[model samples]
Structure formats: C-alpha cells, structure tokens
Target: MARKWAGTAIVIYFLILVFMYWYLFNGDTSLPEKWVGTAADPATFLNARELMLSEQYSQIRNFMFFAYNAFDWIVYFFILLFGLSRVFERVAASQSKWRIVQAAVYLFLLSLLSYVVTFPLSYISYNLSKSYHISTQTFSSWMKDGLIDFWVNFGQMVIIVSVLYWLINKSPKKWWFHAWILSIPFFFFMMFIQPVVIDPLYNDFYPLKNKELETEILKLASQADIPAEHVYEVNMAEKTNALNAYVTGIGANSRIVLWDTTLNRLKEKEILVIMAHEMGHYVEKHIYIGIAGYLILTFAGLWLTARLMNSIITRYGKVLKITGIGNLSSLPLFLLVTAMLLFASSPLSNFVSRYQEARADQYAMEMLQDKDSAITMFQELTRSGLSQVNPPLLVKWFRYSHPTMLERIISVENYHTVEK
Candidate 1:
C-alpha cells in the first residue's frame, strides 16, 4: 500500500515540476513588443533599452525578489490550509457528532472576537490618516467602510471553506484534482468580476459628467484606440487623500476611474501622464500577463501540495490523533508546510513585483512620450500617499514594488542620455 502511494506521489511530483518549468521558462511572447518608444524619437527608446539591460540580470530584470521569493504566494496558501486543518482537527476530536460543528462554531466565534481586538487598531490607523489630513472621512464613515470590506473578505473565506468541506465529504480521493480544475476558472472569474461587481460595493461612482475633463481623457483614449466611455469619479475623498486612476472592469462596464483626490490634486499634464501610464498597462496587456503569471504560480503550489499532503497525513496522523487521511483535523499539518515555504521566500518576493511595475512604467513612458509629466505625477503620488521614495536596498528588497525614487529618475534620465 505504501509503495503504491509512493509511486502515485512521485508521478504527481515529477509531472508538476515538468509542467511548472515549462510554464515559467517557455517565455514565448507573441503579444505586441510592449512598444516602449515615443512617436518622435525612436532612437531614445533604444538607447534607454541598453541602459535597462545593464541594470538587469537578463533581458528580464531579476532583482532579488525574482531570485528569492517568487514562490511565496504558493507556499503561504498551502501552509495555511494544511496546517490549520490538522491543528483544528486534532484539537476538536470528539466522538460526538457535534464535534465538527462545535469546532466550526468556535472558529467563527474566534474570528468575530479577533475582529473586536483588531477594530481598535484599525480605528487608530484611520484616525492617524485623518490627523495627517490624508483622510477626510469621519470615524463613523470609516467604521461603515470597514464593515463592508469585512463582509467582502468574509464572503471569500466562506467560498474557500465551502469548497474544502465539499472535498472532504464528497470525493476525498479526487479532491485535489478537482480543486485545481475549479481554481483555474475561479481565478479568471475573480479577474473578470472584481472590478465590476466587487469594487462598486464599497464606493459611490458616477459617470465623469465633467465635460472638460471627460473630453480631455476621451481624446487620450481615442489615441490609444480603446473604447472606454464615461470616466467615473469615485467618492474616495470620503476615505483618504490617496490619489488613484485606473482602468477597471471588462467590456461595456469598463472605464477609467480617477479618485476625486487624484483629479483635484494633479495638474493637467500630470493627470495626462498618469492616465497615459494606466492606458499603457491596458495597451500592453500587462493585466492579462499579471493574472496569468499568478495563476501559474498558484497551480504549481497546488500540485506540490496534492502530491505531498496525503502522504504526510497518512504517516503522521496516528501521532497527531487524526483518524484518516481525509480527516478535517489534519489540515493544520498541511498548512504548516505551505506557511514555512512562504516564510522562507518572503525576503525575495518583492523583486518579481517590482519587475512588473518597472515594465508598466516603461510602457507608461512609451504611451505618454513625456518624461516631465511622468516624473511629476509619480512624485506627487509618492508624496500624497506618504510612500517612501527611496529606502535602503534591503528595505526595498523585502517591501516595495516600484523601484526607489533614484532608480526611477535614472531610468527616465536615460531617455535623455544622448543615445548611449
């Protein structure tokens, strides 16, 4: 029996590695060349490209995160699921039919109590933003928003738990296989639905009825030849002074939205540059790329866990008091594995994200074709959000997505570097 299980596990493990290696390293990009050039000065883009090459590990810039922590997300999810399940199962192993129900009830209650504990901390954070004049909302408004965010997050958690429960009761042997199949579409559904159905639940949005601003933005959209209508201005001023402009949703519901603060604070040129940068993301199809990358990462993690979790539970369940491989209580042991991997990779994950951001910035430059506008808008965003402009290299390695202020400046300045 053990030999049979071992063989199955090995096959799954080997196949997973093959699939993952192909997905990550195949690197066939048929998409547009991310144009990365201004209309008038083509040579400038080429020159900047060479400078980018020197700072990068390959054609792809691999700062520490890509090398170090690219797999952290996968690691985290697996650990939390496997580890917590085992712990709770062992702790709640009562013969009563009510044991599982009691455990679930307790878990839900703890979550509520945990909210009570954290609510004060959230309030303090909210008040601090207000004190800094960064937030305009009242405490009552903050609480209301917090509650809404909580409900949304809760809904997601419920979905995950429901699926897990179904797996345990319905088709224990096929759980992992079916879970992966379900996740593929679930991942895309989140990408597709979040902007339209989920985001609007929190904020009030009205069409950009301001003709002057709408016309200016639409003209830019027209240049990009994308069909976007009705700029939506969000009532974000009620929340925070954080300025944002992004294109969200799909098809007819799709549009660019500028937070009120973003519109009010940025000059015409800065706003144009900011909008251009966002348009660049859309035109380059970076959103699809980002989502695809994340899915690949997730699927790889699931494959690893499916290959290992059952083997571990079968061997270790006796010591942990778990009755069977499918025991709900054994999940914590599985979760622990995933968590440990995530913890190990935390120091390097930021690099992958920063690379993505850098590509987006490059795309923005190509679309706007204006260095000055990009600089001002970015600087303003950094300042308005109280974002650290440049931290120690180590600090950024672990934290930031965008490069340091100086790195961004240098990258932009290369465009003016007399063509290398």
Candidate 2:
C-alpha cells in the first residue's frame, strides 16, 4: 500500500511540475502602465529586454518554489514509509541510555540526511541566481555560507525537537498546548537575539560608514518617534546585488540595518524613504502584532497537529512501523504533519504579512511626504531584485509577503499625505 501511494505521489508530483512549467512560461510578461513612474525616465524604467529577463527569472523562481515544496513532501513521506526514521531511532538509542542524548543523536542524523537530500535543489537555486548575475558570491563563499546555514538550522531544530518530545512524553494529550506556551517566550527571545547574535554570524555588521547619510537616517527615525542612535550597515555586496533596508531585533537590540548594496545603489533621498518604511514597522508596532498573530496560529496548528498525529498513528502505526505518538521513531511523522500544516497555512500567513507591509508602505509615504522618492526606490528595488510586479495569482497568494511593486508604486502615485 505504501509503495502504491508512493508511485501515485511521484506521478502527481511530475504532473504538477509539468503544469507549472507551462503556466510560468506562457504567462503574460507585459508591464502594467501603473508600474511606470510619472517621470517615465529610462533609468527608473526597465526596458523590454530587462523586463523579459525579470519575468523569466521570477517565473523560474516560482516554478522552483512549487518543485521544492512538493519534493520536500515526497521526501518526508518516503522517510516514514521506508521506516528509515525508526532505523535512526534504534541507532541513537544504542549509543545512549539517556533519552535526551538519544534525541540529540537522532536529530543530528535526521538533519544530516535531510540536508543531503535537499542540497541538490538548494545548489540549483544558487546556480540559477549566479547565472542571472544576482548572486556575487564565489563557489567557496557560497559553500561556506551553506555550511553555516545547515549547522545553525540543525542546532535550533535539535533544541526544539528535544523540548517537544519531552513534553509529549510527559503528557501526550496536552503536549501541544504546553509546547505552544513555551514557544511564546521562545519567539520573543529569538527576535531579541537574532540581530545581535545569529545575523552577524553570516556577515560583517558595523555602523554606517557614511556619517552624513547616517545622520539623515537618524533624523528621519527621530521624526518617526523611533529612538535610534545609529544606523547599522551590513556588507552584503560580497553575496548578492539585492538592495534592502529593514528594522530588526526587539527593544535595545532593535536597529535599522541597510545593505551596502542599498547605499551604493540608491540616492540619499531614496535611502531615507527606505529608512522611513522600516521605521514604520516599529512605529506601528507590527513586530509585536506579528508575534501575537503567529502565536495564535501556532496554538491552533499545534492543536490540530496533535489531533491528526494521534489519528494517523492509531490507524497506520503498524504499517509505518511506529509504536505511538511518544515513540522516538515517530519524529518523522510529527515533522511531516507540521510541515504540511505550515504549507497549507502559508496563504493566510502571507496575506496578513502583505497587509502589514502595505500599511508600512503607507506610513513611509505619510511620514516622508515624498511620493517621488518612494516610487523611484521601489522601481530600483524591482530592477535590482528582478521582481515581477504583477506576479501570477498563485505565487502572489502563497509566496509574496508584500504588495507587488506595481501596487506599491501605484499607491505612492495616488497617495496624498495630510499636511503636518
């Protein structure tokens, strides 16, 4: 039965891939009139060739998104069906009597297996970005970064998985609720530490080198009522050509960070506009709101996962070679359920994110009262990132966390900020 289901899954996966290829390749690539700035300067407007390149790049990326997701589902299913998870559990148990030690070993091995399985698709993505001249990192640098990513992710997963199972072992019926309770604080802790700790591991961060520009940004932040003393800049030119600026961390750790690419590529006014948008996130308290929303969703998701996991184990326990929910070997089953639920929830989560982002955009325009700079900055961002302003509905629904560049620019054009 498992083999039969696996065969059907493969066929469906390929069929879906075929449909995506056709859909992406055949989609309209014409730029909407609204996307064009009022000035209509060539410097701010992408030409036909550039537009085509952008369209193709975005479409390929969209295709890859579907492919990667479906591939992950398939991989998870196979791991469960083949009882490979149980094999890992047995090996780890043999190494240690302590359940925590066993869990750590099992998780490490599982993470390693997952990384090996997923590396090919990840490398393909990197190669595609390089071929498009988007990524500036050399092969060695990319590999180094990949290693960093793997270990960091694995370390986090180990902690999470260990806590989760311990909770389950203690109270299977109430574990999800317990986990959700613990996760609330964990979320805030990560938010606080990420800017100070995790982010600097990948790139060098320092105070903005351009004192004049930093002063201008600080003034904007002050006007927005953000208590920012200095702006931070990361040396991103070594890895990618993408332009970005954002606020990160919480409380004292909170700071505005700009990519070196942004400073090198954009005008002072444009950078200020970007800074205003970031400050909007803080002023609006979107970070706290986002966390609250996430906790709510997680509460519901964990509840559902627990219910479904129990139901599945009740029926397919013997077939999948799993003993019960608290069994060490059931980690794959738990992961599979959570992964699917998360994927299913993407459209909702992304919709909320897009709305928050749009609000921030509005705040930026209102605060700066600079529509022209806003429009031009967005255009430059689109050009730099090869973003599709009017993406297909599916991609927009599931993947986009912000309004389309077209929508953002159009909104700026029509916006009339109140007189201060």
Candidate 3:
C-alpha cells in the first residue's frame, strides 16, 4: 500500500508540474487593457457589475472572485498553505473515519492557535500611531474581530467538509462532476455578494460625513471623470493604524473608502492620486476582468487535478485527513497544491500586478502632476509604518507591494527626467 501510494504521489506530482506549465502559458497574463483616462464611467460601473452578475451562477461565482482582493487572497492563501503543510508534516497515518475527523478537528484548532499567535501584534498595530491615537479600541475589540474572522472562516470549511463527505460517499462515481457543478454556481454567487453582503459585518460605513471634503473629493472624481455622486468615509482609524484606500466591489459596494488616518495625513494632491489610482481600477473594469480570471484559473486547476491526480489524492487522502479529491476534507490538499503552483509562479503574478499598479499610479500622476506630494507622503508612510526605504530587488519583486520607496522615487524621477 505504501509503495502504491508513493507511485501515485510521484505521478501526481509530475502531472501537477506539467499542468501548471500549461496554465502559465495559457493564461492571458497580457498587460491589462490600458484605459488612458477614459476607461469606463464611475457611473456605468453599475452596468459592468450588473452584466457580470446578470446570471445567477455568475453572481454566485463573482462573490468568490477575490480579484480586486489580490492582497487578501495572497495572505489567506499563504496561511492556508502553511496550515495544509501541517498535514504532510505529521508522520503518523490514520485511515479510520473518526481518526480522520479528529485530524481535521485538530487542524481547525491549530488554525485557531495561529490566530492567537498574531493577536497581540494586531493590537499593537492599532496603537502604533501616537497622536490623537484616534483609536482607543481595546484588546477586547481586536479579540472580538479576531474571533469573528476565525469562526467565519472555519464555518466555511465546516460546510464544505460536510457536503464533500456526503458527495464522496453517496456519489463517488460522479463526485467530481457533482462537485464541479455545485462549485460553478456557488463560485459566481460569492463574487456577487461577498463585498455587499459580507463586508459590512466587519466595518461600519456611513456616507461621507464632512460635506466640504465630500465636495472636494467629488470634484476630484469629476475631474478624473469618476461619476460618483457620493463619497464615503469609513472609521478605519477606529480599528487600526495601517492606512488603506480602495475601490470596493463592482457596483453597490464599489464606493471608495478612506481610512481616516489616510484622510488626516495626506494632502489633497496625494489623496486624489490615491483615489485616482483606485478609480483607475474602476475605469479599467478590473472587477470584471478579475471574475473571469478566477473562474478560468480554478476550472483549469480542477480539470487537471481530475484528469491526473484525482485517483492518487483520493486513494490515500485519508492518511492526511483527506477523504478524497472531491471531498471537502481534502480541500486543504487541493488548496496546498494550488498554492504551491502559485508560489512557484509568484514572480509572474507579482509582475502582472505591479504592471497594473504602475499603470494606476500613472493614471493618477497624469491627472494630478503631483509627483512631489506623492513622494513626500510615501516617505511619511515609510517612516510611520516602518517600511524599508530600500529593499533588495528580488524581495521587492517577490514579497512587497507598492514597490520599494526607492522604486517609486526613481520612477517619478525618471518620468520627470524623461519629460525634461
């Protein structure tokens, strides 16, 4: 049995490599379509969203898109990969159903422990800013959010496990087909509703409270040709010190959010650039592109796994708390393989993203010509957040986003240099 499993594992590993090669080559990693200032309307944003979500299945999958959420996906995917590694890290093998269930249970507890490990660091992150300390959120507040995050994620895994177990036991012959059929519609639904339905559970959002700032931002949007009638301000400063601004989901949830810290620190020139960069996302129709990207990537992975590794993973899956390829108990393994593939291709993925981010920054710079302010504010960000001023080239390409401070400075300098 051991030899049999080993043979299966070896074959599966080779197929994974071959199929991943196919994916890297086949994926349209072409530079995202450029949208000089005139990509799409900030108003017509609704149309783009509606068209994507028009089909019920597409809406479900859209909720799962996570395209605009590249960073979160990066974070979660890595953590989950680490968690999955624990399965293989263990030397003991258990094949019984109860024993396998216990393994899954232990995995869940281990994940919780990882959350606890990060708890204090998360709290300190909220308090790092000395002034106004705008946030006095206690450790308890941080803990509460942590618990919510933990349970929400675990619950998702739980549901998946239950359904997968049922499918494997009852429909083993058609498990993959059934699972894929269910996943396709479910995937689209997630894309449609996650931001609108799920995000509010975490943050409180009110329409832009200060009318002057609202008008100022609105005028900036109009100048950028973003047709947003209302701007929103979130109490992000209440939660943590890290600043963020992003164009949310496609339509209803597409409002841009300003961390109050961001609002307080940067000048209008810098802020507008941030907003314009976000609008670059909107006008470029990244949301649509993202939904399509995920579905294609997921289906491709699934297709290859079914064709090559399904029997191997399923046959010995119990040894690692995995029941079968189509079982939710085996999701960690699937996730592990997917992450490995992504990790190996991290450079390419980051390269694609850096290109998009650069384009967005250019859109903002062309609109504002605020290179000076952009540099100054970024310098402040580096100082306050302890971002390394210069990082090794490989690290910047592989791990960092927003580029190194030096990268930004040089890019701006060169733009000025070339224009002169």
Candidate 4:
C-alpha cells in the first residue's frame, strides 16, 4: 500500500514539474511600465538580451526552487513509508548499547542518507546557475561547500533532535512547549556565531580594504546612530557574479557585509546607499524583531506539529513503522510534519520579511535622501544579477523576502512625492 502511494506520489511530482516548467516559462514577462528609464537611456529600462536572459534564468530558478522543496517532502515521506527510518534505527542499535549513542548514530546515518539523496538536485541547481553564467564557482569548490554545509547543518540538527527526543521522553505532553523555550536561546546562539565562526568556513571576510570608503560608511553608520566601528567585505567574486550587501548577527557580532561583487560592480554613491539600507535594518532593530517573530511562529508550529504527529501515528503507526512519538523511528514522520507546516507558513513569514525590507528601504531614503542613487543601485543590481524586475505572484508570495526590483525602483521614484 505504501509502495502504491509512493508510486502515485512520484507520478504527481513529475506532473507538477511539467506544469511548473510550462507555467513559469510561458507566462508574460512584460512589466507594467513599458519604460523604466528616462528618454535619455531607454536601454537601462530594458535591454532585450538581458531581459531575455533574466526571464530564462528566473524561470529555471523558480522551477528548481519549487521542485527541490516538493521533492524534499516526497523524499521524507518515502523514508517514512518505506521503513528506512526503522532500518537506520536498527543499524544504530547494533552499533551502540547506550540509547543516547544510538540516537546520535541513527540521526547521523539518516542525515547521511538524506544528504546523498538530495545532492543530485542540489548539483543540478548549481550547474544550472553556472550555465546561466550567474555562478562562478568551480565544481570542486561547489562540492567542497556542499559538504561543509551538510556537516554544519547535520551537527545542528543532531543537537536539536536529541534535545527534542529527550524532552519527549521526559514529558510527551509538554515536550513541544519545552523545546520551543529552549530553541529561543539556540536560535540566538546560531545568529551570534554565524558571522564570526560559521561564515568564514565558506568565504574569507576582511575589513573593507578601501579605508576611505570604509570611513564614509562608518560616518553613515554614526549618522544612523549605529555603533558600527567597521564595515566588512566578503570575498564572493570567485563564487558568483551576484551583487549583495546586508547586515547580519546581533550585538558585538553584528556587522554590515558587502559582497566583493557589489564593491567591484557599483559606484561609491551606490555602495553608500546600499550600506544605508543595511544600516536601516540595524537602526530599526529588525534583526531582533525578526528573531522574535520567528520564535513566536516556531512556538505555534511546534505545538501544531506535536498534535499532528500524534494524530498521524495513532492512525498509521503500524504502516509507517513508527513505534510511538518518542521512538527514533518516528524521526522521518516528525521531519515530514515539520516540513509541511513550514512550507504552509512560508507566505506569512515572507510577508513579514517583505514588510521589514520595505521599511528598511524607506529608512534608507530618509537617511541618505538620495532617490537617484537608490534607484540606480537597484537597477545596477538587477542588470548585474540578471534578475527579473517582476516575478510571478506565486513566486513573490512564496519566495520573495524583499520587494521586486521594479517595485523597489518605483517606490524610490515616488518617495518624495509621497512625502509631499
């Protein structure tokens, strides 16, 4: 019966992929405003070649995004139905007499299998970006990064999963609540260490090489009342052609980081405007707010997951080979339920993120008071990244953390008008 369902799921997955490929690529890529440029430089508005490339790139990227997520759910579902989790559990039991050691071994084995299963799709995604001339990473470099990501993520997952099961063993009824409480600190710890420890594993970060530009950015930070002592730049040119800058971490770890691509591609004024936007995030305390919001959602999601997992186990425990809520064999079901809930709640999270981003944009304009540079910066970003100015409604809802390029440009153009 599980095989029948799995076969049906595989069929449905391919069908959805076909539909997405058709729907995304065939849709109108036209913008609302025909000309985004002044009469002086219409090419800035829409270079035909660039627009075509952007559309193709966006189409493929959007397809892969949904496909990867859908397939991830399917993979977890397959593991649950096929007794793969049970196999891992037995394997772990054979290796360790201690339950905690068994749990760790089980999780490690499961994670290894999941990584192997998912690597092909990830590789394909990387190759697609490379084919589009967006990613500059070599195969060896990309593979190294992939291994690093897998291990880092697996380590974190082991910690969370172990604590979660321990809580379940202690108080099955209130474990979700307890786990959520513990996650509050864990979340912040990850954010705090992310910049200082985890980030350097992938790319080299250094204080901005241009002291003059760094001084100007420091001045902007001071004006924003940000206690930023220095600006940092990451070496990203070897990995991608994309332009990016952002504020990350909290308290002492917090720093504004510019991708080397951004520094190399953009003018000084544009860089300042970008930095101002990042500083807006810091000034408005968006990081803490975002963390708070995430924890709140996580609290609810965990509670729901616990309820849903019990209900599913009650009905399908024998078939799934899940002995109980606390059983190591139930890990796949736990993961599946959590993944489904997260996917469903993505729009809500994305909406909050977009709102925060818009506020940051507003704050940037108000601080810098330079609409032209702001507009041009986004334009250059769009051009260099070959990003679609406007994407599909579904994509925007599910995927966009910031306003679309066109929306951003229009907002900046109308900023003064709205103020008046």
Q: 1-420 in candidate 3: lDDT tens per residue?
A: 544644565565556445544433343322123421221211122244432222222222222222212323233333433335345324212433563464457457545654665555454444443222334566677667777888777766655555655676677566656766677667666556765676777777778776777787777778767768877777766675556687765555457778777788777777776877787766676666666766665666556555544665555444554444543435445555556555555666577666667777777677667777766666555443434344334445555546655556556645552253
TM-scores across all candidates? 0.68, 0.96, 0.63, 0.96
Clashing pairs in 2: none
The lDDT for every candidate, in the order shown, is 0.60, 0.87, 0.55, 0.87
CA displacement after TM-score superposition, residue 402 of candidate 2 (Å): 0.5
**lDDT score, residue 395, model 2?**
85
Candidate 1: tens digits of C-alpha lDDT, residues 1-420: 434544554565456555544433443322123422322122332244433332222112222223223233333233333344344444455533664454464345434544665565466556656765668888788778788877776666557655765675677767766777788777767767877788888888888767787888888888888787678888898788779888876656677888888888988878877777677777777777767766665666666675677776577555445566455554444455556555444455567666766776786677667788776676676556654333444445545656765466556756552222
Name model 4 segments beyond 4 Å from true.
Answer: 33-43, 417-420
Residue range 1-420, candidate 2, lDDT tens digits = 888877988999999899988877887654556544553322358888877788878998899999999898888778888888899999999999987788889988888898899999999999999988889999999999889988888888788888999999899799999999999888889989999999998999999999999999989888888888989999999999999888888889987899999999999999988888888888888888888889889999999999999999899887788998987788888888888899889999999998889899998888889988987898899889988877887888889989887678878878997787
Compose the digit string of candidate 4's lDDT tens values, residues 219-303: 9988988898988999999999999998888879987899999999999999998988888888888877887898889999999
Which should have the higher lDDT, number 1 or number 3?
1
Residue 324's lDDT in candidate 1: 63
All models, RMSD in angstroms: 11.5, 1.9, 13.4, 2.1
Clashing pairs in 4: none
Q: Which residue ranges in model 2 land beyond 4 Å of their true spot?
A: 29-44, 417-420
Candidate 3 residue 145 C-alpha distance from true site, Å? 1.3
**Candidate 4 local Cα displacement, residue 177, angstroms:** 0.3
- Residue 245 CA displacement from its true place in model 4, Å: 0.9
